[model samples]
Target: MGGRGAEICCASIPRVWYPGMMVLVRWDMPDGLKHIVKEKMVEVEKYDETGSIYIHFFPNDEVRVVVSIYPGYSTAHPIRHYGKPENINP
Candidate 1:
């Protein structure tokens, strides 16, 4: 999913994470979070850091999600775990 200036760096990952590349979208949130973004465009990238969902782009054009959290907080869904791939699921 590159436009111009960037290129996909991730090559591949376990197929079990996502046996089939799926485009998952949930339209409703209790109160729609205006902060959740597709790309890393956070305002306070350091302290007031927010949560993020990273989809690794494989060479075959497939992907898996990777969530990262900083010290602060975010409006996105509260996840159970992060930095541990064994617990994450598609």
Candidate 2:
């Protein structure tokens, strides 16, 4: 969302059906320092909830990223309720 900021990079997974839900994220560190983390795994807690997805990054693990995409919505779509990018620690 809005030019890559300090968060980790992400890409959406298409085809696979995940119930519409908001991913919640929590890192061992705060937001700004999250980039330095290497390997990480996103423990998918629940499905269909609005919030941040918690993540723990491995020291040597490359940052794992996930981006959400709304197919019907155009790229110009406003990131409010749909199609917002999020970072997964691992």
Which candidate wins on lDDT?
2
List pairs with backbone clashes in candidate 1.
none
TM-score of each: 0.24, 0.21
Compute the lDDT for candidate 2. Answer: 0.33
Ten residues in sequence with the least summed lDDT for candidate 2: 71-80
Give the Cα lDDT of each candidate. 0.32, 0.33
Q: With candidate 1 superimposed using the best TM-score fit, by how many Å does residue 63's alpha carbon deviate from the native?
A: 0.2
| Candidate 2 lDDT, 1-90, residue by residue in tens | 122224434623334436443343434434774553222334333323233222323234323223333211334211222233332222
Model 1 global lDDT (CA atoms, 0 to 1): 0.32
Model 1 alpha-carbon drift over 4 Å, by segment = 1-50, 70-90
